[model samples]
Structure formats: C-alpha cells, structure tokens
Target: MITLLLSSHAQRIWGERIAVAVPPGTLSFLTAEEALAAEGPSAADIAFMTREVTGKSSPSHPTPELRGFDAVVEKSPNLKWLQIHPAGAERPIYRQLRARGVKVTTASGATAVTVAHSTLGAVIAINRRFPLLADAQRRHAWEPRLAERSPRDLAGQCAVIVGMGPIGRNIASLLGMLGMRTIGVRRTAEPVEPCERVVAYEQLHEVLPQADWLILCCPASPVTRGIANAAAFAAMPEGAHLINVARGEIAVEQDVIAVLQSGKLAGAYLDVFEREPLDAASPLWDLPNVLVSPHTASHSLGQNEAIFGIFLDNLARFRAGQALRNDVDNLG
Candidate 1:
C-alpha cells in the first residue's frame, strides 16, 4: 500500500475525492500529525502538502503540539515523493528534498485560469476607474469626474505579460478576446500562442514603453527577484497600469510606491506583497491608486478540486510507474 501523508486542509477539502481516486486498500491516507507520530516502517511513502504545511506553523495542530515540515521530513524515513500545492517551492526545502532523492511535483497549471482571470479583472478595474467610483460610493455621492476622465477601453490597448507561463498564456488569450494586443516575455524569446509577440528577458525594456498594462506572472527565482525596480518603472509609459498576480518579491515594494507617488503609474493591483498579511502600517494600504487583495487571486469555488485532480492524475501515473506531470526541476 502507498502511504500518503496529507495536510488536514487537503483532507478537509478533498478527502472523499482522494479516497475515491485511490482504490480501497491501495493507498493509506494519514494526516500530517498522524504521519509524524507513525513508527519507522509505517511512515508515509508520499506527502501531499499545501504551502501552509511547509510553513513554520503546523496546519493540523498548534505549534507546541507539532513541529513543522522539516521535522516531518526527518521523521518520515520512507517518504519517496512530495506533492506541493504551490507552483514554487522554497529553495531550502527543495534542496533538502533533492538531497534525499525524493521526487517533487507542484500544482503549477492548476490555478492558471483563476489567476489569469483575476489579472484581466484588475486591468479592467483600473482602466475603468473603479477605485474612484468605489471611493465616491462610500460617501454616498455621485461622481461625474469618473466619466469626465474618459475611462480607457481594452480594445486596441497593448499588454506586456512577463513570464509567458501557463498563467501568462491564459491571461494573454483572455486579453486577446477583448481585442487587446498581448506581448509575452520569458528567458528565451520563443514564440507562444495568443501573444502577438514574445521577447527575451533582455528585451523587456525595449517593449515596456509600448504597454498600456504590465502584468507580472513570472515565477520567483533568484534571477527574477526584484526584476521590477526603479529602472523598470522608469521605462514604462506614464499612466500604465501594473498588475502583479505573481510573487511580491518579483517587484521592489519601495520602487512601486515611488512610481505611484510620482504619478508614473496610473495605478497598481497587487494580489501578493513582499511581506504577507501586509503590515497595516504600510503605505500601500492607503494608496488611492492601488488595490490590495491579500493574495487571494487564485481563490474560486472549485480551486480545491482542480488542484486535487492534478494529484489524482499523478497518483495514477505513480501506480503505473509513468513519469509524473508537473515534476519540479531541481534548481542547482
């Protein structure tokens, strides 16, 4: 039997589905707490976790009751594979897992559609001056200035999508449906569909001035960390909207604030922040031109099921000794 250690949140969300996917007596499901307490030979063979499970706190129990994922990994000697719900894995944890020769997989494309939809929504909200209208509504006042400003339309507008991954491609396709021109950027300039043009990372500056909207959908890596800084902001055309559905570390917060302050950017929609639970004292909360979403862009009614489906497919592949989908390439 394949012993799988599942996070309590996963169990709560997709326990029935998981049980049905893996036939009776073929796989044993153990909560993280249970796996940590298991004896040598009874330890888990696979760990299915979310970002919460990898955190400093335990998702199943209080911190005092259970140690974090590192401890779980150390205790579960039989663990052979790990499936993380998030697209990117923490470098340290990934390195340790790699050293142990454990195969790792990620839920990369599972939330693409949701995240892409959120990005397009943000673009439209900013262009249509939703923030101004929302502020006016709070005071029970009718605002004609919103209309006087001549809200921009998506038609004929240009959008630069950084990363060109599944999320970026989905965003490009959605934007294209609205008559917006989509240009994609990646490490290589390899052409991708739905994007009118795809350019290399080195050409980002060349295309920045042409974009009415700049959407960040890149993965967070050492090379990409803080790629959006003062120089990048300065290269963009004035009043261009910024949408970040990717990691907050991809953009420098201080630079973003500076650009907003100088009116270089018309507005920004940020779903993620450099520091999560974004400090209440941070100026971003008070910025009139910025919309903050507490990193919930990927949330939707069926998000859990979509992610679990990836796991189910991989489980089938595992049983058949086939290569898993969305396998993580170890970063050297």
Candidate 2:
C-alpha cells in the first residue's frame, strides 16, 4: 500500500478525501512526533505538507536524513511526492525535495476567489476612506459631509494590476466588473482577463503615473523583493491609492511611509507586512491614512476543504502517471 503522511491542518480535508481518492494508499496522520520516530528513511510512499509544517516545526527545513519527523522524499527511496499547501514555493524544502528527484505541487489557485474579493474590498475601502467613517462612528457624531470631502469613485478609475497571476487576474476581473479601466503588467505581457491593456515589466514606470489605483498581487520572489521603492512610488500620480495584497517585502515600507506622510498618495491599504504580527509599537498602526489588516484578507470559509480538494485531485494524477496540476516549476 502507498503510504501517505498528512499534517494536522490537512488531516481533516485531504486526509479524509484522499482516503476515498487513493483507495490503494494507506493514509495516516503523522504528528511531528510520529514523523521523527521512523528508524531510517520514510516508510511512507508520499507526504503531503504545508509550508508551515516544513518551516515552523522543529528540525525545520527538510534535510537528507529525514531527521525530526519531517520526511525528505527524494532523499529516501520510499517517498515520491512532496505536495505543498501554499501558492508560493520559494521555501528551502521545495528546493531540497526537487534536487532529490521528488515531485512537488502547490495549491496555486485555491484562494483566488476569496483573495480577489478581499483585494477589491481593500481598494474600495481605502479609496472611500472607510477608516475615517469608522472613526466618525466611534465618536457618535454624524458626518455626512465627510464623504463629500473625499469622493473617489471606483467607476472610471484606472487600476494598474501588477503580476497578472491568478490573484492578479481575479482582481482585474472584479475591478472590471465595477466598470473600472483595468491594466495588467506581466513579465511577458500576455493577455489576461478583464485587462484592457497588458504591458511588459519594462513599461511599469510609464504606466505607474497613469494609474489612479495600484494593486500589488505579485509573489515575493527574489526577482520581486523590494521591487516597489521610492522611485516607483514617486512615479505614481499624487493622491493615488495603493493596495497591497502581495508580500510586504515587495514594497519598501519606509518609502511607503514617506509617501503617505508627504500626501503624495491619498491612502494605502495593506494586508501583509514585512514584519508579521506587526509590533505593538509600530507607527503603521497609527497612520490615519493607512488601513492595515493582519494578513487576513485572503482567509475565508472552506479554505481548508478547497486546499484538500486540489491535493486529492493531484494525488490521483500522480498515481495515474499524468502531469500533476499546480506543479511547481520554479527551476524552469
């Protein structure tokens, strides 16, 4: 029987569905403890892991020895696939698994719908001054005139969406449905949904100034780290709203702070941060013009189940000798 080791979070969904999906495989939930107990290489045929398990658990970072219960697939003769739960596979374990000849897949488009909706809400909230309205409510004061003070209409606005991946394309679709002019930027400038114009990365500077809204949806890779800086922000039109649903490291936090302070940008809505669990004393919390969420914009109901469904489908493909869906092809 093929052995499947499932992490706790994936246990409820993938573990349950995979049982029905892979009847020949023996599915077992391995706690961090059970995983480490094996004498030699992994006794299992396949392991489904979340990036959190690979990085957060003890003996973090999968090694050749399969030490600390974190199984190294290709390193061990018995294991074959190392399926990761998150869309981004820039972690160390991914490389280790690939080098060892183990196949890797990801849940790339699972969170697209929810993440796109959240991005839309963030864009609208920042443009409409939702924070100011909430503050007005806290004071128990009527401020009908405040809405007039900052009137930014979503319709007719030009949004430049960066990345044009699943999340970016979804954001563009939503923005388009709202009657906004959608622009997309990709590495190769391919056609994407709801985008009237798709431009290459080289044209970013030219497009930045024309955008009334800038949405960041790119993954935080080595190529995109700190891609948004002082010059990029300066290139945007004064009073433009910035929405970041992408990795915080993509933007220079200091540069964003400077722009907001100078009134060059109308506002910003940030879901991710360079430093997670944003420190209690951080000034970002007090920035009146900025709206911050604790990286929760993409979280929604049934996320675990959705992630599992993808895993189950991919697992079937693995056994059938077919190309797996959402396979990570970073090396290429």
Candidate 3:
C-alpha cells in the first residue's frame, strides 16, 4: 500500500478526492503533525505539501508552521517523493531532500500567466514613469516638464530577459506587443518565441550593453544567486532600467543600492529583496530612481485552485506508475 504524508488542512480539504482517486485499502495517510510526533522516522513514502504550510515563508525567515513541515519531511525515513506546491522547490530543505534521492514534483506552470502579467505591469509602470508622475501628483504640482525627465518611448528599445522559463517566455510575448525587441537569457542558448536571440547565462555581460531594460524572471538557484552583481550593473547601457520579479537572492542588494546611488541605472522596479520586510532604514526606500514592491508580483486569484489540479493529476499518475507532468530535478 502507498503511504502518504500531508498537512492537516490538505486532509480536511481534499481527503475525499484523494481517496476517490486511489482504491480502498491501497493507501494509508499520515498528516505532517502526526509525522512530527511519531517515535521514529515517519515511514511515509509520499509527502503532499500545499500552500497552507509553504505559503508566507522566505529563506531569511520561515514561519513556525513551515519549519515544522520541513522538519517532518526531513525525518521521513521512507519518503520517496514530495508533491509540493507551486515554485517552492527553491528552498534549501528541498535541495537536501533531493540530495537524499527523494523525487520532488511541483506546480510550476500554474502561476506563469499571473506572474507574467504582473511582471509586464511592472515594466509598463516604469516605462511610462508612473512613480515619477505619482510623486508629482503628491505635491499637487502640474509638472509635466517635457524637457526635464521626459519618459522615453518603449518602441525600438531592447529588453534583456534572464531565466526564460514559463514566466519569462510569457513576459517576452507581452513585451513584443509593445514593439520592444527582446533577448532571452537562460542555461541553454536556443532561440525561443518573441526573442531576437537567446544566449547562455555565461554570456550575460555580452548582451548587457544592448539592453534598455533588464528583467529578472528566473527562479532562485545556485547559478542565479547573486547573478546580478555590481559588475553586471557596470555592463549595462547608461540609463538602463531593471525589473526583478524573482527572488531577492538573484541580485545583490548592496550592489543594487550602489548602482542606483551612482546613477549607473536610470531606475529599477524591485519586487524582491535580499531581506524580507526590508529594513526600515534601507537605502532602497529613499532612492528616487527605484520602485519597491512587497514581493506580491504573483498575488492573483485562482492560482491555488490551479496548483491543486496539477497536484491531483500528478497523484493519479503516481498511482498508475505514469510519468508526472511537473516532476522536478534540483528545483531550478
């Protein structure tokens, strides 16, 4: 019989459907709380994680509930697979689990559309100078000074997009509608849709000077951690803008601060930071050329339901010994 470990909330919400998918007497269940309290390693063969325990957590800070979940998974002596929620495999715990030979599946493409749209929104907001206009309105001033600080046209400009995953690809497609040229960057250099050309990650600097805008849409990983450092900023064309919708680890915050201070970059729209709740005295708050967000780029409706469907489908495939849709390797 297949033994499954899950969160208490998952059992309450989808226990019946899970049971319906599997034949009676063919599977047994153990909740995360039960696993943690077990005498020895909870002999669970599969662990199903949802947003309940995975949501609202970051690398710098994990919620108590999230820590507990990680502890349970780590202690599972027989855990062969983990059906985790959307894009959560970036966690260090998951890397450890993968090193231990446990299979990890995710609902990666579930939030692609939502995040892609949000990223496009950030690009547009910065392109049209919404932050500057908002500041002008705050003073009740009619400062549409065309000669000074005039917004440039997006058409005929270049965009260098890093990490061309589902979200990145979608962002490129949207950018194309605005008549902007796109260059995609990823592990592989193969050409993709809506991009003039694709380059390997190592060639990042080769194309930085050509970018009018640089967008970070990659998942946080060993290769991507601190990928955007001071040297990267130095390579970009003067007055280039930046948009980071990915995790904060992808860019060095201190280096980002330095570049903004030096006016090496025209402006930056950041949704993630190296530290969560960004310290009160952070220079990012006072940077006139930066737009900061609370890392809510993918906060859209119906995402949870979509991820749930991917998990359920994968569960049925697991029972049938079929290939899972979003089975993962090393998360990134």
Candidate 4:
C-alpha cells in the first residue's frame, strides 16, 4: 500500500477524485497533520503539500514539533516524492529534499493562465492610470484633468518580458492582441511564438531603453536573485512601467523604491515583495505610482481545481513509473 499525505484542505478538495482514480487497496490518504504526528516511522510514499502547509517560517503544528517541510521529510522515512503546489520551489527546501533522495515536482503550468491574466491586468491598470481614477472617485472629486493624467494606450507599445516560461508566453500573447510588441529574454535566445524576438540575458540592457513596459516572470535562482538592480533601472526609458509576477527576490526593493521615487520609472505593479507580508511600514504601500498586491497574482476561483488536476495526472505517471511532469531540475 502507498500512503499519500495531503493537507486537510487539499484532502477536502481532491480526496474524492484521487480515491476514484487510484486502484483500491493501492492507496491510502492521511492529512498532513496526521502524517506529521505519526510516531517512529511513516507509511507515506508521496506527499502533496503547499507552502502554507509546509509553514513558511515555522512548523504547521506546535505539538508535533515539525519545523517546516524539512522536518516533515525527516520523519517520513518512506517518502519517495514530493509535489509542491507552487511554481517556484525555494532553493533551500529543494536542496533538503534532494539530499534525502526525494524527487520534487511543481505545479508550474497550472497557474499560468491566472497569473498571465493578472499580469495583463496590471499592465493595463498602470498604463491607464486606473488607480488614480479610482482615488479621484473615492474623494468625490470630479477632476476633469484626470483624463489627461499621463494615461497611455497599449497599442504600438513595446514590452520586454524577462523569462520565456508558460506564464511569460501567455502574457506576451495577451499583449500581442493589444497590438504591443514583445521581446522575450531568456538564457538561450530560443524562438518563442508569442514574442516578436527573443534575446539572451546579455542583451537585456540593450533592449531596456526601447520598452514601454518591463515584466519579470522568471523563477528565483542564484543567477536571478537581485538581477534587476540600479543599473537595470537606469537603462530603462523614463516613464516606463514595470510588472513583477515572479519571485520577489529577483529585484532589489531599495533600488525599485529609489527609481520609483525619482520618477525614473512611471510606475510598478508588484505582486510579490522581498519580505512577504511586506513590512507594515514599507514605503511601497504609500507610493502613488505603485500598485501592490499581497502576492496573490496567481489566485483565481479555479486555482485549486487546476492544481488538483496537475497532481492527479502526475499521480498516474508515478504509478506507471514514468517521469513526472514539471519536475524540479534541483540544480542546487
């Protein structure tokens, strides 16, 4: 028998489907809490967990004394695979899992459509000054000049998208429909359909000045941490917008704040922050030109359903001894 552990919430959402799909007596379900509390040894063969269940900064349950996914993995002696619901797996966590000889998979493409839609919405909101208009409405001030508040159109604009992954490609396609040209940047200058042209990392600076919008959709890696720094801001044209739907550590917060304060960039739509829950006193919260979301760009009504589908399909692959989809490269 193969024991599959899931969070109480995940079990509620996908339990029935999983039970129906897997052969009888071949699988058993255990809530994350139950699995973590198990004594001595664990019968679990696979674990499906989200960052929340893994505990971002601490263990999920105080009694069990597990201090994050690493602790959970340490206890589950029979665990062979881990499926993370999020697209980007934290480097440290990935390393720990790999060291234990456990394979990790991510739900990378599952949230692509929702995240891409959010990116497109942010681009339009920044260009059209939607926040400013909303503020005007809140104050009950009918300012006629609001229409002239530097609102720009998407048509004929140039967008430079960093990272040519599934989310990036979807954003490019949506922007293309608005008549915007997209230039994709990746490690290799491979041909991506939604992009007008794809360039390597070395050419990022060369194309920055021509972009009306710059979007970051890359995963967080050693090479990507703080990739967008002061020099990158200086290379962009004044009044250009930035949208970050990728990991927060990819851009330096202080540099972004400085550029936004100096009006070097018109605005920024940030869905993630270097430090999550974004310090209560952070100036980015008060910036008129900035739109901040609490790292919910990938959230949608269908998110759970979509992620469950990915996990379900991967379960079949695991049973058949086939390679899992969206397997983490585990470079560390």
Best prediction by TM-score = 3
- lDDT tens digits by residue: candidate 1, 224-290: 7888889998889888888988888889999998988888999999988787767799888878768
Writing each residue's lDDT as its tens digit, candidate 4 over 232-256 gives 8898888888889998888999999
Give the TM-score (vs. native) of candidate 4. Answer: 0.92
For residue 280, give model 4's deviation from the true position in Å: 1.7
Off by over 4 Å in 4: 51-70, 145-150, 330-332
Global lDDT for candidate 3? Answer: 0.85
**lDDT tens digits by residue: candidate 2, 1-332:** 66676655556544555677666444555544455555655666677775445432222234333344344343356667867767766657677777777788878788888889998887777777788778889999787745448577789999999888788889988888888999898786778877999987778888998889888888777767787789988898988988888887888888888888888888888887777766688777877668888776667766656777787788788888888887776423
Error of 3 at 308 (Å): 0.9
Model 3: CA > 4 A from native: 330-332
RMSD of 3: 1.9
The C-alpha TM-scores of every prediction are 0.90, 0.88, 0.93, 0.92
> Which candidate, 2 or 3, has the higher lDDT?
3
**Residue 166 miss distance in model 1 (angstroms):** 1.4
Candidate 1 CA-lDDT value: 0.81
**Each model's Cα RMSD:** 3.2, 3.6, 1.9, 2.8
Mark the 10 consecutive residues where model 1 has the least summed lDDT. Answer: 57-66
- Pairs of residues clashing in candidate 2: 35-69, 36-69
The Cα RMSD in angstroms, rounded to one decimal, for candidate 2 relative to the true structure is 3.6
Worst 10 residues of 2 by lDDT: 56-65
Highest lDDT model number: 3
